[model samples]
Target chain A: MTVSSDTSMIHAVGLRKSFGSKSGETVEAVCGIDVDVRRGESFGFLGPNGAGKSSTMRMIAAVSPISGGSLRILGMDPATQGPQIRARIGVCPQEDTLDTELNVRDNLYIYGRYFGLPRAEVRSRTDELLEFVQLTEKAKAKVEDLSGGMKRRLTIARSLINKPDLLLLDEPTTGLDPQARHVVWDRLFRLKQQGVTLVLTTHYMDEAEQLCDRLVVMDKGVIAAEGSPLELIRAYSTREVVELRFGIGEHEEIAPKVEDLAERVEVLPDRLLLYSSDGEETLAKVHERGLDPIASLVRRSTLEDVFLRLTGRTLVD
Target chain B: MSSTADDGSGALPGTLIRATWVTDYWLTVYKRTWKGTVISSFVTPLLYIVAMGVLLGGFIKGDPAKLEGATSYLSFVAPGMVAAQAMTTVFGEVTYPVMGMIKWHRTYFGMIATPLGIPEVILAHLGFVLFRVATVCAVFLLVMTPFGVFESLGGVVIAFFAQLLIGMAFAVPIYAFTVGLKDESAFALVFRLGMIPMFLFSGAFFPVSNLDAPMEAFAKVTPLWHGVDLTRMLTVGNIDGPMVLVHVVYLSALVVLGWFWAVRRLTRRLTD
Candidate 1:
């Protein structure tokens, strides 16, 4: 019932969502996922496709209902206080729903008015937001005329019209050039610096490593792993990962021979992974055992390694 | 960051009616496109009077008075034009505009995310549709005065009310269909296969009794017939007590059904 709290900006305990007309055939998009996104901290939901990241974000954004269990945003129940929570939160959905009939400036101006902002204030903020998104030159252009990157930026700018305390972004930069992705990252970084709490969903491991203070890797309608990106790597993966490739049939023959050289050995169809404290030392051990790998590479372990180790598959898959 | 008193209860009754949001947004849209819509609403009635009353009526050699129960063919057709205009306004204002807000523009998605509820959105649309129907009827009534179609001030007022009831009655259901539509083809089908036949069969241009039994039965069940009957009763002072009750019930049922369907659709869209 309090407006301000030092607790999580969003909290969910046993949240669940399922869809389908039939009983047993229902697809549980989110299955009893518990989360606590603290105020002023950037939280990330890291997962691959069909992992229920967007569904959870939708629940927190108050657009999708909590099928069961407790959920709160800005210290209010979404079912009862949806409007108030939504008023205090800004959401940039996975898909851009910009009004194509209106030009860029009107898109911002009209959405601002929906929050009851004054016409003069909407005008001023329109100018400010266009400048923020670097779309001032294209202010009068219809939304249909803008590129994908430009539209995504405008959506982010539009979400900030009310200067929301909690911001929800679903796949903020899914399909964009590197330059456009960096622009979005920079804006999000600026928002973080200004003490805005952000909860974002993305399958991109690098995006999570770059922006998140703490993250949860979701899989199969639940949180498969949760920690800081670095913490998760330390817990599930070693300091360095060595990839050894060989001819298709040789990988299986070499798998057992190199099993004891590293802390963990994973055999793949065309390659093998050796998780070791020292990648160079592990490679030397592989050579000492007379295993002539077709190719070998040593690299620092990443969140992708942890994700792959935890879920038994690649993150981007 | 600005902290104010926490009214966390958020229990202000009627505070969330929030029709003003739609009205505010629509007023902006309407202001930008008012003249075009106004001209469009009047064109149909004007054309109907010219083509049906003037040109078609001219070709008929029989006594127009004996056939129409009016001294002038223009007077008889003028009331029908009001009925036609009201029906057209309902279909136009209620159908695509509301659908576009929900599906295409996704404006309602942004709206329901605010303090506004689904019912408030529906009511605001109904309010806008009724307001438009009333305005168009007023304009049509003004155009009819010179032709001596206004029997009395009461008749003019009755005609306006009839237009509003008829508009809302059709609007509620069409608004439902608009929300449920998955594609644009269904909208074209409504206009082509549905609305055209309703207009022709519902006594908007002529009396329903002039048609055969099956067509008459279809007209009696439709909201357009009740609306046309109400408009005719007002314009000509030909009120039969039982007939008035039938029109009122038919329109009321349609309004209720439309409202029910619309709310259910909103639940499915917003909650799911």
Candidate 2:
């Protein structure tokens, strides 16, 4: 199978993945979906857990076989040319698979050697990667001793050892703290600046907004929406959201009173989100209705609101 | 740092020599912990020879013909110890380390993400296991020299090769089993039921011929029995041409079969 060289970095048409359980039942993890990721673009799969983001990432990484449909990575068929495709792409799996037995520096060096990199080149690259991840001081420390953020950085550094043209990150900062997430985000932004085409899966709408040039919102094994973060928000949500929290079960009662205050009012369990062009105006109307709330805030709409609008559920829940 | 544009046509060098990098990774890891393993590889085997071969051989007053025609029991059991030690060493290498690489540390996942494929990963790990078996056998032979177990230097050299074959024969299948396992419970069962019986009944401590009809026949079918017999023949200079051929073929077949299953299983597990 020959693929055109000038094609997108990742191109898929109606791709699918189904897993067979021991009880002879089939679970369709990813039902047919189409996606295209161009060169130097940070593409994202944004969804909640079990939304087939990981399944799709695995197929693109050439580690998992696609059950159906056509897929090409680096202009090569992943099914027939897994090694060749893998040689040019970096995969940072969701979980940290760092070698705990080796120190931080050796982890990078050994992984580089696996790619048949020259010894001197691997040595120098290991040094540079340690610095790139801001782990130069911890280069000699064992991987098990590093914090979660450091391990994620080392994993990213290990992925870049071969200087891949396309990088795949599966939830790059899932379990990280806010500060750690920003650190990882900064490093990823730098990689994108270097023109590495990145394809990442993230449930964090903020991560998708901060890093992705284009993204698809997936739910229940299919794409519900796709566009740039701004496009997604503009299409599915209002410019701003007025968040009003009443007493525990008072949101349902309060939502009706504020119904005409915005274009739409979504009554969630703990809070009522009012979708409107002007959040402050919506909040003023909510107060004018004589309905009091425990707390109220006006903020610009984000991808989270887009996800909620499209799926009728929050990104995390 | 170099921003060389990838043309999407460059291929990885998927050569055998590149697989040695996995072995190199293990060797580098071993360098840090070799001191801890030295005692088990060398001293423990030495202690076994002294305790079982020397101290216990003192009590077994038997005719040379009955004790495999050897003049002393120490010489009789020394080669068996070499084969047993090889089995133990290779078993250790293939079990927890293999499982750890797959499930715990996920080192194999990390390797497959690179240009290294499943076959290369399996071969490289087996290569490292062979190195470990060689080291353990060398140390065991060196320790045995003080006890005058060597009939001839060439005989001892052949015994070393026999130990290597025995180790590989056992390492590959156990590696396959290890990769399939989700937990370490089966490993304990393997040690208790499989390894212990083979160590005791496979002519490692005494001639299997001394057992009853059914038991002796059972021992003959075991891979370690072939290993022990081959090493004993080489160490004792009682080289039997046809029997030697039989032992080598049996061990070689096991190694080949084990390799086939291991590679297939590991590829399935690592890829999908």
Candidate 3:
């Protein structure tokens, strides 16, 4: 990605982050990498834990120092102008660092006050944000009294106190239940519609596919593949994957017989996956080979398939 | 930021104003929890004044030198109580709250996520501790006025400032130590080993002259002793300029040193 000051929200070249472990060894969290996020775009970092997504997010948020390489956020160098950069960007951290000392409303108000927002502005913005996150009824409630999903909403509202241009959410709905996740996703979707630039990291393929306009699949502190969810699935995996589960311990034995039946065959412990553009043709070929399968199913390729194809590992360990 | 930031252009430039904002956060939070602290800062110390200074002073009849240049034991012990209260209040504030900010709740991480730096967070939290000490000392002075413990109004005024310094002497350095802490376990040892001994033997209730050489020397090196000595001298109108200078310089240096140390520790802990 070329560095452009005007349209670029985030531009990085060979960015790296290294941490000193307790055992006195240098642990490279993020190896040298390049990333660029344009204005109003939703970018995702799809990787498992220890994949350096959080380190990259921290460096981009201007909270963590860049260990090496040059990076810019909103066209400002984070090393030299961290405060000025932070003043403009909203950060929803992985853990909800909500002010347990204050009520839901005061949490938003005090955060705005930290930005030197005027009293009237903070008050009105606090009200507006509470309503936006659907926490107006719980405005006077203590932070500890709120549910897990409510705390996350309050954190998102607090981050938006400054009306930031770029919003950095680190696994926004990570610990949330399915219903809570949908609530957060809906709120985030609205934020995207309002044209707030979002940078998020998640191992959830559905989350990345639903939220991201473009994404990078990271593995072992480096980006393995970078593209849209559809593009990644198209590039790295077949159009569809056919799952055929045989009798007990028949997958490995049946894999060799079905090797020429489809474009590719993956033998797992309980099932054999045949990858091809046409899953029905592959299944028909399997039957023509006199392969009797107890169960069979077909599904369109997803980002998980792309990840499994690229890294040969599951997204969640 | 564009429309409402006109008033944010404060008298000073940008650096100190942000610190005040962080301090403002403490003040706002303190508003909710201030009621719980009254007994410790005000009621308990005042109770000690009634129990030890007034009740015990009536029994020391034969000794004039034992009063330590004061007309009564109440007057002698009153200023000492003020300074000791500062140390207790500030030490209490800095220990668990500092640990809570750093480790338990990670409130400091929340602050640093904004434009507020680590230095501002440390300074503002310490400022809030000093504010608590000032209020506790001031209220102590106000209520103790009825007892006729203060020898001079001017002396009480100076002692008030001395208590602030003493409070910070404990607060800033302890803050430096606690801001990097991982848990509240070390605080039990600090209270048992550091706070309890200093409160008792820092010439607060009794004169250090009555203490042995090693014990008195230990008391002299503590910030609480300097606070008690300086505050006592000012409250009794027995001003010792050189000794007061020693106390002032010592506490002030500790305050600055502690502040810088806390900043360094917080910087290391919060940043990469």
- Scoring each candidate complex against the real one, what DockQ results? 0.42, 0.43, 0.45
Give the TM-score (vs. native) of candidate 3.
Answer: 0.94
For B13-61, candidate 2 gives per-residue lDDT tens digits of 4446557667658878789778988899878988999999999999998
Residue-level error in angstroms, candidate 2, position B104: 2.1
Candidate 2: Cα lDDT at A151 = 94
Candidate 3 on A25-116: residue-level lDDT in tens? 99999998899899999999999899999999989988889988889998888887677777888999998778786888888888888877
Q: How is the predicted docking of candidate 3 categorized under the CAPRI scheme? A: acceptable
Candidate 2 clashing pairs?
Answer: none
Give one digit per residue, the lDDT tens place, for model 1 in A7-93: 778888999988875466878899998898898999999888989998888788887887877997887888887667766788898
- Segments of candidate 3 deviating more than 4 angstroms: A1-4, A246-254, A267-271, A289-294, B1-12, B61-63
> How do these models rank on DockQ, best leading?
3, 2, 1
Worst 10 residues of 3 chain A by lDDT: A1-10
- Rank candidates, lDDT, best first: 2, 3, 1
